[model samples]
Target: MNDTAHALGASRTLWELAERRAALTPDRPVLLQGDRSLSFGELRERAERVAAGLYGMGVRPGTVVAWQLPTRIETALLSFALVRLGAVQSPVIPFYRDHEVGFALRESRAEFFAVPGTWRGFDFAAMARRLGAKGVFEAYDGEGLPDGDPAVLPPPPAEGTSVRWIYWTSGTTSDPKGVLHTDRSLIAGGSCLAHALHLSPDDVGSIAFPYAHIGGPDYTVMLLLYGFPAVMFEQFALPDALEEYRRHGVTVAGGSTAFYSMFLAEQRRRPGGKLIPTLRLLAGGGAPKPPELYHSVVREMGVQLTHGYGMTEVPMITMGSPDDSAENLASTEGRPPEGMEIRIVDGEVRLRGEAVCQGYLDPAQTEEAFDENGFLVTGDLGRLTADGHLVLTGRLKDVIIRKGENISAKEIEDLLHRHPAVQDVAVIGLPDEERGERVCAVAEQAPGTAALTLAAVTAYLRAEGLSVHKLPEQLEVVDALPRNDTLRKVLKYKLRERYSGTVK
Candidate 1:
């Protein structure tokens, strides 16, 4: 870690870190979107003003605010403003719809809700109203954001260990669990990421994913720690977003395995040419990276590809450093930073660290998530290398990660069961080179019903309000889904083994 950053990392809260960074690098750009930029100084100053504006609206410390906005500069500002007020924040991914969003709002009991109005033809404001959300407000642009004098703002939070964040992650079943976190935990996570990447102020980063995701604060903390700027993409589609990346001279980029594949696909379009002339490193987590994909990025794109392992519970646990060996970089998920302990108990990965979340929102869920040793029981199955790198084998949870987003198998299965043509269904994640994992639905047709097609299944899921990303990419009709003779439970592993490479 940089000596200056290490010293700044000792700050008690995210607001303190932002204030410290602003004091040191007031003029330095911290966030870039299109032709506009927010400097470290401006981030603190504007956030305070926004905080005062929020306070005038009855928001106060400990208020639960839920925001489902895109990856935009205004979104970052709104989030930091909430942090400034010491309010508990719950950010929902923009891709999530009525099912997930409604559940998040209801579970979080958010006192205030922020949306992007009619974003990309979707009426999020209307959806919020439909969900009967409290204090619904549109936060689409700077002009629409509430503004007031910073002088009216209260003192920034001094304590950092109090749980102030609620991040949602798909669980073993249909409902998403709210993973609790504190400011200190998030700081530790960002420090691990910033230190592992060994980023300098000269480096420019890019955030292509939804800022509402856990990676939002994770990435923002890196900027505050390193005093660097990152380009924000609200609607990140390939080829179109590339121009902005090149325009900003992004040196570090990559959101997940899917992002890597997208960049590689663009690079292949112009063989023997640099995808982004200034690009030097590709780094991300939240999805699996095939070893071959790593080698391909290094060989073809001429950039260092360092993958990591993280989740909503612990934003960053292990991350591959740029100085690591190619073999280690290609295979392992990298090494944990100081204070992060990784234990493999009974072939399952358990974590004990400052970055680990406090617990889930539900008390019983919290009790069940931790062990006697107090280590967070990560459902992932992995082992540590002799040298400290982590190599994940598989996951014990019934969740599919397609393009870095988790899709609950039971959620989709429950919806699929409603289809009249489906008698029984088993949803399994099949390995894919590009997406890391593809959602594949295998079904046994209902009596007197014909075989189901992927089109019909997807259409049904869409009508059921399932997100676009969770729709099954492949559909298979079998005489019977492989089930155990003991309790007649669907054998998902057998399905995975049978169809691992069978689907395209």
Candidate 2:
């Protein structure tokens, strides 16, 4: 990393980092997808123009703007424009539909909503209108963004302490919590990722996940800090995206354990040759990486597999370094960065640092989310090794993370309870080869009710406005649900153990 790169953490806001990087190498490639490559210079200039456009559309500093778009240059540009204008941004994953989208707009009280207008066969604008989203506008196409002159734009934010990001965390509860993040927090999180990965200006990266994800800014900040380019995959799938990765000579890739497995599967199909010859490391986090999966990635793909542990609240808590021992990398979630303080309180991980979010948007949730010591309760079960490595054993929260997306068990359970065939239901995450965890719905059926099929349950969930990713892959009907002797709360661990050996 260069001197300016090292100073990114000290920078007040994201716009400052963008300016610093552009000053260092204006013409250098920063974001690439297909034939389009956005340079640092273009990123700055175009974002300012977009900012002006937004200003013309009535966007101003501290305006709450919600955007739901795919991984594209326009999305990043619009995001940076919001940063330049010091507007609070709430990025909704493109895959989210009316249920999640509606909840976000109403909760955040977003002044404006940006949608991709019928992207991938879904009518986002229509959905936005149905949800009564205010100031709804298309942002996918170049023509959709509001237009104005840069001279009309206000001065960029000088501080990063105020909350400028509202990231949704699908927790154990039915409703998703809005995680509050500042520019400094995001920069700190990104710095941890960039420095730990030891990425150089020459290393080419890829964003297989949605740019709206918390990892988007986490990874984008790395590109700005190190002055490297990353290929953006609007829609990522093996063999389909492999050509682009090979064409770009992507050196670093991987989104989560599922991503590593996908690459390994692709490698196994062609055993003799390298999948991507330029590939050197596969690093990611968001879900628990199986020990066997890591071994397979390293052995089969011939690339180092390093995983970490993080949530929406704290984007990058620990990251695996290229210099770490293979055993350590495979077993542990690596170590926390310099300023990150990770404390294991009664086996649950607690964190305190600049990278951690300010708290949830709900004051009650915020107060309950952190301990009196000011440490954010991660609700994840972990322990620190003698070598300072983080060993994540399990989670205290009843949330299922499949393919890097957090699915609330309680959310599905609450909705499933309304089903006519079910009396009681417990949603559990079962191990799967493709998705890290396949959502399994175990239900105690009503007496005399017919057996429920997986398809029927998923269709029912779809009708209930659940996201496709959160649909239950496996359905197991039981006569009764196991509950403890105390208050009769269903024990999910028992269900996981019982269903581990079975398939859908």
Candidate 3:
């Protein structure tokens, strides 16, 4: 990172950092969406107005506000507005329905909730009302967002150590855990990413994932630090979304391993033609990346692909730098940034850093999440190379990562056990070339019950209020699930080994 960016990164709060960046490059565009663009100056000024408006709506400093909006310029505006107000903001993914959404609102004790009204044909406002969410309001566009005079707003948050953000992660639990984070932690996480990628002011980036995700603040911090603009894709789909990428000259893109696979598939369709003429690098994290996929992307897509290690608890633990050797870049998850301590204890990855989150909403879970040494005990099993690169071998937790999102196997298993056709159930993640890992349910039929098909299993889970993204994509009926001799626990590894090859 350059001296200027490193100095700008020292700002105490996210709002302070935005103010500093806006002062430096007020006219430069910070966010691009289709034909629209938001300048750095406008981001600061308009967000203050929105903050004042939120003040008029009874939102005060320390007030808990939750928003479930898509990836759009307006979403960023509203988020920053909350930052300006020093409100404790909880972001719920738009893909989550009543189950996850309700859990977040209730756990966070959100005083105000912002929905997209009817987004992507789903009635979010109606659902919020149905869930009895407090202070429900619609804020999909700039016009819909609250606006008032900045004079009414109090001073922006001066401290970044206070927990101001609550991010949801399934982790190894059946229900989502609210991960606590502060502005300083998020800024530190983004700094690790921005510095590792070595982005320049000229580099155009794109966000193809949900803005409600922890990656939202992670990416926005990078933009603020580097003074670059990233295209905001409300709905990212190949072929259809290619035009905007080309229009904005997106130089850096890729949300996860799935995104790389999707781009590779598009490039394969055209053989020698470039997928995006200006594209240069594809970087992301959250899910496993196959070594072969890395080689394929560099050889076929004509771009540098760098994967990293991150989660809601620690947004950027390790990130592959563009300057690293191709071999290291392909095989390892890259090295941790300064101040991020990666310790391998009992073959599991434990992290302690400024970027690491404070803890979870549940006090007991928080107490159990960390070790005596104060390191966050990540359930991921990994090793450190002699050169400091991280090589993740497997996860100790029974969680399935599909397209960068964590899906709890036990959550699905518990729900599936309720099905009349399921006698025993074990949910495992199978290797998928496109999705990094695909959710597969291995089940045994109940006595005097019919066989369960994949379609039937998905429908049953969906009806049970499980998020669409968490539904199993494959199903296999067996006479019995493999169990260990000692505890009679279901051996999920055996199921994974048996079905790993079924996908690819």
- The CA lDDT at 141 in model 1 is 77
Per-residue alpha-carbon lDDT of candidate 3 for residues 19-49, written as tens digits (9 for 90 to 100): 9999999999999997799999999999999
Taking the tens digit of each residue's C-alpha lDDT, what string does model 2 give over 197-313? Answer: 988899999998888889999999999998999999998888999899999999999988657756876887899998999999999998766565677678888888878777789
State in Å the error of residue 358, model 3.
Answer: 0.5
lDDT measured at residue 214 in model 3 versus the true structure, 0 to 100: 87
lDDT of 1 by residue, 1-504 (tens): 789989988989999999999999999999999889999999988888889889999899999999988888889889999999999999988878899899999999999999999988999998988899999888877587888987887888889999999998843235889999999999999999999999999999998887877888999999988999999988777899989988999999998876786798688788978999999999998865667678878999999999999988999999999999999998889999999999999988999999999999999999999999999998887889899999986667677889999777756876776687875677899999999999999988876776699999999999989999999999889997764221123567788989997855
Lowest lDDT 10-residue stretch of candidate 2: 482-491
Score every model by TM-score.
Answer: 0.81, 0.81, 0.81
Q: What TM-score does candidate 3 reach?
A: 0.81
**Candidate 2, residue 249: CA error in Å?**
0.9
